[model samples]
Target: MYTRAEVYSPLQNTAIWLAAWLYSVESTDETVAALTDLGGRHSYGGQGLAALLLDARASADLSSHEPVVRLILWGPGQAAGLHAGSAAAEALGPAGAIVIKAAGGFSHVLVPRYWDDGVEWRWFEEKKRLPEPSWLSPGEADSLLSRATEQAAVLIEAAGGTRSDLPNPRLTVGTLADFYDTPGLPRGVTPRAAKVLARADRVAAIVETVTDRLGDHSYDPQLFALWRHIRTARMAGVADAVQDYRRASIS
Candidate 1:
C-alpha cells in the first residue's frame, strides 16, 4: 500500500497542479499549446511541467529533474532512459520518491521532501532550496488530477469547448487554438533536446510513431521529448505539420 505522502508529493504546488491539469490534455499539439500558455504566465520558480519540458533554453534550479518527471508522467521513451546518476534521479533519490502511471498516459511524480541530500543537497542548503510537500497521500493523486481536470475544463469551456468535445476517461483534449496561434514561442533548449533533435529524421519518425500510439490509446515519452525539440528549434514548420496531423486524426 502506498502512503499518503507518496500521492500528494507529486502535487508539488499550485504550479505542478497546473501542470497536472495540462497533462490531462490528450492531444500532444494541444498539450504543447497549453504549456506555451503557461510559460507565458509563469517564471522559473513557478514554471509548470509543460514550461520546463517545452522550452529548451529555459533554465531553473530544478529543471534538470523535468526529464525524469516527464518520463514518470509520460513514458520511458527517453533516448537514454533514466540515468541513476543523472540530476533527476539524484534529486528524486531513494528518499521515498515515486512515479505513478495510469491508463491514457496520465501520470505524476512525488517526493516526500525536496531537501533530500540526493541532488547535491549541500548546495541547495547553502543557496536556495524548495520546500517539502506536507499534504500528500497514497490515494490523493486521483483527487489532485480531478481538481486539475476541473480547472482545465473550466478554462476550456470558457474558450468555447464542451465536455463531450474532449477525450473521455483519464483525460481530455482542450481548446488551445488561440494559444498555438499566438506568436513567438520562448527560446531555449536543454541538453536533452539538442541530443534528440540531432537526428531530424529520428525526431520526425518519433512524432509519427507517437501519433500512432495516441490513435491506439497510448502515450509515449518520446512525444514529450519531441515537443522539447520543437520548442528549442522554434520550428514553426514542424509545429504546423503536427497540427496538420492532429486535424487529420480527428477528421
Candidate 2:
C-alpha cells in the first residue's frame, strides 16, 4: 500500500483530481457478461476508459503523482454516479490513489490529505437501478470546485508546505478540454458527434451547438476555440502546440 507521504507530496497544490472511471461492471468480452452486463453504445465501450486508466496505472507520474484526494461514506445511499469494486481499489491501493464509490448524492467531496492507511470500499444494492452520473450544472460545478480548492489549500497549509512548493499537474489538451467542456461529455457529445467536430469546418458548428445547448448562460467562444485547439494538440502529442494554445488563452 502507498504511504500518505508518497501520495500527499505529489498532490500538494493541485486543485483538480486526476480521475478515471469504470462506468459499469459489464464486459463485452464474455467475463461476467450476464451477471453484470451494463449495456451501452458499442463504440463507447470499456476499451477507451480502460486504456486511459491503464496508462495512468502504469505511470506513477500520471496516476498517484498527480493531484488527487479521496473521501468515503459508509452505509446507505451508494447510488451516486460511477462506481467500482474492492478488486479495483486493491489494485490502486499500492499507488495511494483512492477509488471513490457509491455516494453520488451528498455533494462532490474533496478527499482529505491526512487519512489512515489502507483503501476503503462501498457497495450498492443489487436490485435498485441507479441513474448514471451526469455532469453538474455550471453553478453547481463551480461551487464544488471552489470548495475543493479551499480544502486543498488548507491541507497544504497544515502540512507546512507553501503553495509554491507544489506544481500544477501538466494536463493533456484532451483531458483539459474534457474539463473545460463540463456538463456535456460521455453524453452531450456522442462518439459520432465528436468525430464530426474533428474536422476544421465543423468547429464553428460544434461551438454553436454547445452554446445553444447552454441556453442563456454566459459563454466564451474564444475559450471554446482554445479548448478545441488544446484537444487537437494533446491528441497529436504536441507539447509546444499545447503550450501555444495555453498562452493564447491568457493573451
Off by over 4 Å in 2: 1-129, 132-135, 161-251
True-vs-predicted CA distance for residue 94, candidate 2, Å = 13
Cα lDDT tens digits, model 2, 19-98, are: 21222121323322211122121111234323433332333222221122232211122222223543323233211222
Instruction: Report lDDT (Cα) of residue 5, candidate 1.
Output: 19
Clashes of each: 10, 2
Residue 28's lDDT within candidate 1 is 44
Per-residue alpha-carbon lDDT of model 1 for 1-251, expressed as tens digits?
Answer: 12111111111222222233333323445444544443333233354444434432122222122221221211123221233454444555322333322233323333323332211111111121222222222223233333333443333334332234333312222112222223322222223322222232233333332233223213333233343332222222222222232333345
Q: lDDT, candidate 1, residue 118?
A: 15
lDDT of 2 at 123: 21
Question: Considering summed lDDT, which 10 consecutive residues are worst modelled in model 2?
Answer: 7-16
TM-score of 2: 0.21
